[model samples]
Target: MLYWFLKWVAIGPLLRVIFRPKAYGVDHVPAEGPAILASNHLSYADWLFMPLTLPRRVTFVAKAEYFTTPGIKGWFQKKFFSGAGQVPIDRSGADAAEGAMKSAMKILAAGELFGIYPEGTRSHDGKLYRGKTGVARLALESGAPVIPCAVVGTDVVAPTGKVFGQWTRPVVRFGPPLDFSRYEGMSNDRYILRSITDEIMYEVMRLSEQEYVDMYASKAKELTKAAKEPVEPSDATSSAKKAS
Candidate 1:
């Protein structure tokens, strides 16, 4: 299959040689059966390096745009993403979040590893942000143990904007599986979901040793972009006129 070929022959081998990612607690990964690999999304390479370090295939719920772009670059992106065990789902509709959860749940029901970034998006400032509760919902719905994962130094390897950049050895650490069996059947409870998500993120913070930001990563990016935008002279004039 394309996955094996890419993993053993094409990309994975090359990445391992170049980046030389060092992974710890790989044994914590279940040798078989279903589980959630919930990780901090540091950079685009987080998906690549994490799976490259594991023998078991990890299926990530990726955005449909990764597979639907037009052009030669789009072709390659689709191929590479597919080869990396990514499944694309339309993440724009109102049910987008539920759609992603269904895809992951299907993978878990079939007794496979489901990888997810609970942070929803990569951290722009390298601080671990508050995780979305979808991951907790997945764990509860599928009755799978959640393993907290920390991928360090990947941001240096492939930063936010650049496709590839300065090489830095990344380290991946897998914390013990978290069991939320006590909170079974409480997936519909928003408070319970928040608590479960926060607990998993706490473990991820300990493993990655990164600063924790209570806000969501996407919100932080929006705030940063807004702050950087120049105040237009037209807007300034309009404000002055209103004051007058």
Candidate 2:
């Protein structure tokens, strides 16, 4: 398969060597069965470095646009993402979240590790943003344990919108999996959704050790503005409001 071949014989070895990531609590990941890796999205580098640190094939739901375009870049995106096992999900409608959640559930149902950034988008300020309920929803519905992960130094290695930056080594830490079995059979409840999402974000915050920001990272702060302030939360809406 392309995935295994890439990991064992191609990209994976080179990535691990170049990234030289520092991992903590990797043992927290389940050795077998389906599970969800809930992580903070810090930068483009997070996409490159996180899964390399993991032994299993971890698949993230990438924007569908990445799979379509009109040039060499598009071709490369399709080839690499497909080879790396990422699924493309359209995030352009009210049902986008639900569709992505369904796709994630399908992965779990097939007994695979699914990666999700509960924050929904990259954090412009490297702060842990409020988490969307999709991760919680998937966990509730699919019975997958949620592992909290953080990729430090990504914001530095390749901060958003920079196009390119220094290839400094990044740090990746995997916290103990948060068991949501207690909330089993409670999917579709807003309160339960908020609670589980918050719980996962709390662990992410601890791992990243960044200030908490309740707003969507792209809001309140201009991702292209080139200036960022470290704060707990801003005037932006909650993750649920912003993500869905």
Candidate 3:
């Protein structure tokens, strides 16, 4: 299969030679069976280095646009993402969340590893953000254990919003699998979902040693962008007039 070929034969070996990435606590991953690898989203490279260190293929959901774009470039993009163990999901509409949940549940039903970033989006400033409850919902619905994972230094090798970055060894760390059987059949309970998500994020924070931010990563990015935008002179003048 293209996935195995790329990981072991084509791209994997080259990355190993160049970056020499190191993995710690890999034994925490199950030898077999379904599990969720919940990790902090620091950089886009997190997916590459994290799965590279694992023996099993880890599947992550990507926006459907990546696969649906038209043209020659889109063809290659689709193939590359597919070979990298990414599946496409339409991340729009009211049913988007449900659709993603179903996709992940199907993977778990097949006894495969499903990778998720509970933060929902990559951190803009390398700080761990509040994890969304979808991860908790997935674990409870699928009856799969969650493995807290942390990948450090990926931002150095592939910084967000940049094409490429300096080479540096990235470290992937895995913590013990979190079992949520106690909350079985309670996935619909929003309070329980939030509690479970927070527990998982706590472990991720410990493993990554990154500052924890109570805000969502997407919101944090938005606020940061808003802060950077220069205020219009008219707006400034209006504000001054109102103050006077």
Candidate 4:
């Protein structure tokens, strides 16, 4: 109820008036059924604009800390995210992946739309990163089709690592549903998972027209951070200078 109110009545109309997001290929989404809407992660605003363009409510798992924070701010944060169709999940530790999969499977089982960023994390840069195989496993395990989606210009609306960005119209595009029934019951096969994930990423790349990076987004971010850190002089260098 809050979800509908926020989307159609409260926040949705305001966003529409301001940003005027456009959507294409929305017909690709099933009217009523379980489906994975696999998309590239460019910016945090991707979730807002993509779902705003759709009639159906799209649910995505967010870090539990968003809902668990203390005090008055946390209460509003929890309600806002919940109204925005986000569910909180603990994203820490080795079991995080399994926990997210279970949550997603439950949503699919209930015949609801489940949104996932196959890249696992938002791209620090605008390029599309290689997708993780969890999306493939979800599709295979849930017997649901995977719809490749791309949201463009969200980075302009809300740039990564920034609070807000200049207003610009965002475009959401949906590609045809990818049916992997041929690989049914083979979700455990690492090779098959890679194949399916790659196929989905290819579609996203095509729709978004972003450069494709073979590395995971998180790994890319780590590399970028490492590059920016100051390097210390080696002990050998210091000794040689002192001796000289």
Query: Over all chains combined, what TM-score does candidate 2 have?
Result: 0.83
Q: lDDT of all the models against the reference? A: 0.92, 0.83, 0.93, 0.93
Pick the winner on TM-score between candidates 3 and 4: 4
Clashing pairs in 2: 212-232
lDDT tens per residue, model 2, 64-149: 87788669999988888888878877454467786687678778988999999888888876677788888888999998899999
The model with the greatest TM-score is: 4
Error of 3 at 32 (Å): 0.9
User: Model 4 over residues 54-158: C-alpha lDDT tens digits?
Assistant: 989999988788899999999999999999999876454468788788878878999999999999989888999999999999999999999999999999889
Candidate 2: where is the Cα deviation over 4 Å? 68-76, 90-94, 222-244
List the pairs of residues colliding in candidate 1. Answer: none
* Residues 165-238 of candidate 1: C-alpha lDDT, one tens digit per residue: 78799999999999999999999999999999999999999999999999999899999999999977798799
Please list the Cα RMSD from the true structure of every candidate, rounded to 1 decimal place: 2.9, 9.0, 2.5, 1.8
Where does model 3 exceed 4 Å of error? 90-94, 233-244
Give the better candidate number (1 or 3) by TM-score.
Answer: 3
Overall local distance difference test of candidate 4: 0.93
